[model samples]
Target: MAQQFEDKFRRKFYYLRLSVTDVCNFKCTYCLPDGYKPSGSKNSSFLTLPEIHRVVNAFADCGTSKIRITGGEPTLRKDFTDIIRVIADNSNIQKIATTTNGYRMERGVAEWKEAGLTHINVSVDSLDPRMFHQITGENRFHQVMSGIDRAFEVGYKQVKVNVVLMKDRNHHELPLFLNWIKHRPIQLRFIELMQTGEMDDLFTKHHISGVTIRNQLIANGWILKVRENNDGPAQVFVHPDYQGEIGLIMPYEKNFCDSCNRLRVSALGKLHLCLFGEQGIELRDLMQEDAQEAELISRIQMQLQNKSVSHFLQEGNTGMTPHLASIGG
Candidate 1:
């Protein structure tokens, strides 16, 4: 039996968000408003495939069953499918997922599915093409929509669409999103805009509480779904009249970290205990050899002891995270 990855608060982690790279194509207003700028280095400093395999193996040994491959845009990597295959080879990993921008889904999703990708979460901040273009600085709104359709055609039972709910941006389009998902098996997630080191001004101007939407869903007869062990921090709700579901991710909400089950690893191989926590613990050196699995797991467990009971977002503390893309938020 695998060992449980439990923190001091007895929060057992079953999910791992592993970032392969920080190179994104989309220039979202909230995340990469200035677009992705590579560090002044010719060589890509992202973790290698062997390093990723070792990290996943160590996590799997500690009972991590779900691994979400994240990035500034994960699909941009040429070896993305190979990365999926590597994780899928491990019997202990039951689910292999990715959170993407959906730019390559139309052309590359079939190959990704064949490589054993089980779940996909695509960021679609706005349904309006013009608004989408304005928000992301990309004119590929229709292309992304078509990619989602292709995802369904290639055998995805359901797709999760992420929308960062900003006050004056796409908040008024809630009804449109509800209608779109009424006939589709989409889990539309509305994430509250979070305060990051670089986007404090934007967060102040556009941040909206997800409680407004959550209360609306409850009043409209949407029932809350019981969360699974490996589920992320989304509070999902379902309605009898609609085929789709709705999820709310409000990090600023009280006790948000009580059910914490996921940890993040940056592309540089540092383990992050909390998204809004301090600088992460380095794990790359231990990943150099397969024989270091035991030590790797030990270091991970040791770091968990330092994870606080909750994030200090209420205290206006965003920690060391400069931007969401920096650590694959």
Candidate 2:
């Protein structure tokens, strides 16, 4: 089943972003649908744990050395810890991380650590309770804050706080959010909300550029000294004398597709070439066929061959659906 395939840049993609579920407990305003209702459909329960392992192992055997677990909220999955352990135990994967909403970390951090989760990224838009509630559409501010504190106490070396920069929504809180890392061990990342998912219509409405953000930070005397991560995205820097670092994930403003080396797997097992991909190869179908490692590797190689260099961020683009939550943002 191993078909010959490769991309233009000669960069062998070996990273897989796997979404565990499309079930999140909280309805964040930016993420939830217009008339939202929680529906963990039998078809939408996402891949079974066994199915997930099969897919991950297939990638690992194909030279995938890094993996990140994401979801509507990956922690919500009952077997999340077990899944983490399985990926961690895989000798081919060097790093294992999860992106979460932070509401559950308070009660699950220790157990998650025991399960071999090495790094964590928490979505924290604002520190103010009222604004936090407005942005996330949930009154779990206290719980989220407590969870983040618990993450620090649990001994996670790289606990990154990801703040999606929304134009007029939480834009004013940037300085305050930056202050959270003044003397803390946690890293902070300011992300430009992409024009994708259900929020695609709001592209022109809420799109905030990275240049504006950098200028604002400089205006407030937050000097940025560039720091680089050879294996990861995000152009990072440190505020002078700051404890950790500040990372700017300017996917819209700056294109890093030339050196891109990652592919995303939807909760349903589709292999997306880019975050804004219109379609993906059905890995679940391949798995159901009882394909061997070499065969699976060939499918991945074929998927990567179709990987485009950059994504179109134009307004009203119906490039993809299932939202960022469904696809593991």
Candidate 3:
């Protein structure tokens, strides 16, 4: 089925970003606005572990070989370890990974690694503890940093840290942040902030472009070198005289939609063709109705074929649905 995962763009859709839950522990200013209330009830809907297993199996049957479990914060889910085991057990899945905030990582990262999680991508915006508190709305900086150390201690060598670039917020921390990961084995990713989630204000206020970030890094005397040239976005780089690599994800400024070979599955089972697109196929209905495996697989294939060439919002346009925490980056 891996052959079927090939898209019209000549790229293979081996990776599937699966959001297991929408509930998060942080209240980042850009991700969620103040006084924000969800349109749906708190306990309204979420895919159970069995349902997720079925969906993952279906995706595997369609040639998805890599799965990244994400969430509002995947660690917040109690059954995360069990879910990792299920993903690891899948014969078709070549790699199992996660993108987390690392707040609860101190408590569960080691165990999670034991449960078949091959690697982790932790989101750490700023190195300053004070600024970290301001951005994450939680004063657990020391703990999150410790969690990164713990990941390395547990032999999770493929660790990466994602720092979203925001003007006037932590954009100035680029050089400082790079220095922190310059010699380390972990890969440092500097992402350009998008106008997604509740970033209507921040998008207008602190929207920073990826080119701006690269210049800033070079200006600060950090010579970035190119590393892996993977197809899944994120322009990667390494230091001229350093070991660890640096990555830039310019989803807004430099659109990689032409090579976009991936699809997102919201925690609630919505098949989002693009991160900035509102329309999605509701797999929950099929799951609830005990849809057959063949039907489920066919529905996913149809959705993939129906995927847009690029996101409508990628051109600085608007009019997409709000994905909330269920849509992972």
> Which lDDT tens digits does candidate 2 get at residues 1-329?
22223476676666778988767776776676442454555655578777777888777776677788998888878899999998987787787888898988999999989988888888888888988887777788889889988988888766898888888888788667667777887778888877665675666687788778777666766665553222456766666667777777787654556656777888888888877776667777666544555666677776576666677564345477656776776
Q: Which ten residues in a row have the lowest lDDT in candidate 2?
A: 223-232
Sequence-dependent TM-score of model 1: 0.98
Q: lDDT of all predictions, in order shown?
A: 0.94, 0.75, 0.76
Clashing pairs for predicted structure model 1, backbone only: none
Ranking of predictions according to lDDT = 1, 3, 2
Clashing pairs in 2: none
Steric clash pairs (candidate 3): 225-238
Better of 1 and 2 by TM-score: 1
Off by over 4 Å in 2: 1-6, 33-42, 216-230, 288-291, 314-318
Give the TM-score (vs. native) of candidate 2: 0.89
lDDT of 1 by residue, 1-329 (tens): 45789999999999999999999999999999999998564545998899999999999999999999999999999999999999999999999999999999999999999999999999999999999999999999999999999999999999999999999999999999999999999999999999999999999899999999999999999999999999999999999999999999999888988999999999989999989888889899899999999999999999999999998898899898989998889
Which regions of candidate 1 deviate over 4 angstroms? 40-44
222, model 2: CA deviation in Å? 6.8
Query: Which regions of candidate 3 are displaced past 4 Å?
Result: 6-11, 35-38, 41-43, 216-231, 288-291
TM-score, every prediction: 0.98, 0.89, 0.90
Deviation from truth (RMSD, Å), model 3: 2.8
The model with the greatest TM-score is: 1
